[model samples]
Target: MSQVVFELQGKADAIKTESTLSAFIKNYPVLNGYTKRDFNLAPYWKIPTRKKEKISFETINITDSLKNGASFDDVLTSLEKGINRPFKNRKEHVAFCLITKGEKSYLAMTFDHLVFDARNAETFLDIFQEDFKGKKYDGSLNLKEPAHLSMWMEKFKAGQRVNRAFLKMADKIPPRVLPLSSGRKGFKFKILTFSKKESEAIAENAFSQAGYLMLMPYALSASVSAMHEIFAGRGDSGNYVIPVSIDTRKKEEVRRQFFFSNTSFFIFKVEAGLAARFPELLNSVKEQMYSQVKADLPGDICRASLLMRIAPPSILGSLLKIYLKGQIASFSFSYVGETAYESPYFMDNKIINMFHMPRVPVPPGIGIFFQKSKENLNVILSHLDGMLTDEESKKILSLLKSRLGVE
Candidate 1:
């Protein structure tokens, strides 16, 4: 249980290999198409400071720990202990616990909410491991410049008609829906495993029938639907919003090195009847998802930054919050899907669980986290301890199985 600390003089080759950010962007289209200019959603440069300190430990070598059934816990503890100025940095950055199990060495990297979102995390891990073999870093620091917020603003200024339409749509949304909570909460982890065969089928059904090549959103929808059934049958208050994290990095943006991530709320407006007609419910879910994306598209956000006209960081943050709350849809799930998970080494401990902080006032929220192994999918839910009893959580999980038909 003792901790060892050391200074890591990263080899140029290793650093290059470790720099898997480019690979991450390539894997997830959701992340690839952004320029640094689109970072208005989540401004990394505007932050008061850049925290680049690293913490390293070498104790109970990873291989030994895994043999003793203490592998994951050791890595988790290190991550929980890592610290920085933001206070939440420990929970916001990815940590790698490299293990050398003879001929099979792997690294485990757990991403914090601050940078890598759920979907991007998985992509990062794969690229990370692939690059860790000491290959030359294929990425160029000379990436394209990010889209300037000012440019986007000019476009919007010339088009007030679009603004009016957006405002009109905003008026239709219900007020007092939900707000992100600023409360301190602990996360619980659950590991759900599926064999390769089962996972392939699930992916096939999701892509072929549902038209979603990625499993994260599909799984998220099913998870939300599950929670909905749980609350509805019990007659407990049933309002929920799904928070989806959006990456503001543009494809041609050089500042992709910077973190400018933002989260968008997706409302799951679940009704008891929708559950009865699963396909119709799914279509409604899909349509609503598209509309939410269209409503607050990244280009539009860049325009928003330009309209504000060189506003102070603090002011911009306030305006962003108001805009997010007003424009984001209502629902019970939060998604953070665009960030990287490059580990320092291969044979790293694979992350098996994740729980997103839920919006305040509401009793339940869900987040999806998957990893490089792809052998596990973690569905994290947070609710009033008393409101969502054990039985209720189990029931919700059961519903998820029936709906997704995952074996």
Candidate 2:
């Protein structure tokens, strides 16, 4: 809930893109987010009018003239700088950095995850582009909530449901996890973008193999299988506990719930042996998914989260650490399904591609994300630095590519 990223790659005039981006962010919903230490349950934001100079645009020209901009170890080094750089203060929460090489440009936005989730990031882009094209961004930026201070009994019951679910998980052997490397902790990304045909094949395979409307289960199955191979190779064996985050916002809710994070998790426990069999694994994943849906587990999670908001963040953090016993999950997973920023253009630039770089905390320190844009599936593997060996990383990615039924 600290910083999250959204990256845009496309053709645009470097100088023009910078100026346009600066203007776009100036008017975004988040200017400078502040959380006063007054112990308030409901977070308050300082969405003040913007200052052109207070917000800075960092341009890393890979063309080799800029210094901190110039002598970067590589693109990833510069990118990590852009992503992990702490906000100047509570008065600042978002940072935009542009990386240019000859005619290509990559625009990155790092914003406070407390205020924006992955979906919020995409909607941010779409809104900005709409504004750039003279069609004002007409999003329902409704920031009002009931404070959720009432309904004690309901909240208690919701908590009980969530607790029971996790407790059940606790009854099993701890999931296999990759031990944290004591190495310096920056993140590295391996991104694979499938072509239109490959994306089509994945959807078709999802239907044929997992069943109708089961793309997510199919994708999750592939991810579990990918990680299982590495663990199997290492002779590590145990059930895999993966918490899959799903967007809680429905189709109609996107317009109203467009500001904050709207996501919840479906915890899946797959036995190691089951992951080796794709068909059986897909069935198991789907079974867990459907049963959870039938039980409205995600809904209970969303309601339970509101109750959690009353606790001070520090206490909440402590309780989380204690409850999980320092092992959160086998890894993190999510499927954003479709692109929110599906437009073909941004400002006057052609919108070539869009993807998200979401971090997984150190306990897990690994996440597999899937997003579809322009009929292509973008698979993003985000993990902490030094967590996976070079060969292991390549093999995991290869396994994902092969597992997804892509070439």
Candidate 3:
């Protein structure tokens, strides 16, 4: 019942530019949605005991001797290095890394999946920046001990609808081994930009025919179908499993008076017969998206029954650890909404980029496409080691554009 939780804290040394910092904070979702009790999913709901450690400035030992730049690669490397250390303090927190790398002049916070949704991650950054400047965060957020898994287990055993759905789904899913390698396996994340003009054109085309705005899920599914045709030689017609997260926080809130999130898998079938017509592919995706948005897990127990077979935290941790070093489910895709709650300000810096991770290492591949503007779209692709080549990806991208008649 304990959710997996990871905590790493550190501060970047660059003098705080309130403008730059504020812009970054605004890029995340939690600030608007968060309340005093809106803890990061992991910190609040994880099933394990919590842990904490305090390290002084000198202990972090980060130096600018090597090189410095705002390159995303460098930032990612630094964050990864800090998170490699095991958590020593297990009491008050069964997790790890409290004040992970404090006084380093940069703060890095990483959360385990059991908690911390897209919104929570953003809120944590907002709190971290405010705390760094010695400003009071009126939100009243705090480091909380993990919730008792036993309580969840009790409810789960009692046949709560969600738990029953999970149990049923777990029973039908055969053991699945993903083709995509975990992020820790040295998978580099690449940022692909789509202009607002281009996305609008695509969405317009889809809506003209389908009568609905094109969503990330639809774009993502189209991208996957195209990739499969290019790389796998297009003869395969079977269904490819794509995991989409359903924010079950509403259900959890009813029971515990707080938000609890659950992820469920959806099957996206490929029809090789329509290989020439990519628009139809996107149309198929829209249909699925429309149905999935309202499809309640509890009501459709048969489909739910099939998905639950994938191990929950306790089992996934063990099986995924060997092939992957850290974090399982690295390569998966979803579309979380993007919009600023209020105007963002930092030390005269404007926020230009917004990035969120896709479920890492979900067999075939994982791609997360997000709406960056009314028309612009941003997609982050995480592929398994040497699976989908650059040429392959490009072909898929072209298919999406040409088929959709996007600019």
Better of 1 and 3 by lDDT: 1
- Give me the runs in candidate 1 sitting further than 4 Å from their true place: 1-132, 142-149, 152-185, 212-217, 233-240, 246-276, 290-298, 301-366, 369-391
What order do you get sorting by TM-score, best first? 2, 1, 3
Candidate that beats the other on TM-score, 1 or 2, i.e. the better one: 2
Q: Which numbered prediction scores highest in lDDT against the true structure?
A: 2
Better of 2 and 3 by TM-score: 2
Candidate 1, residues 123-171, lDDT tens digits: the string is 3443445654555345543224343555554666533533443354343
Stretches off by above 4 angstroms in model 3 are: 1-109, 127-184, 234-237, 246-266, 292-295, 298-331, 340-343, 346-348, 362-365, 371-376, 401-407
For residues 61-117, could you state the per-residue lDDT of candidate 2 as single tens digits? 676665544432365567777665667776766777777655556677777677777
| TM-score between model 2 and native | 0.89
- Candidate 3's TM-score: 0.56
Model 3 clash tally? 47
Residue pairs in collision within model 2: 66-70
Q: RMSDs, each prediction?
A: 9.0, 3.6, 9.8
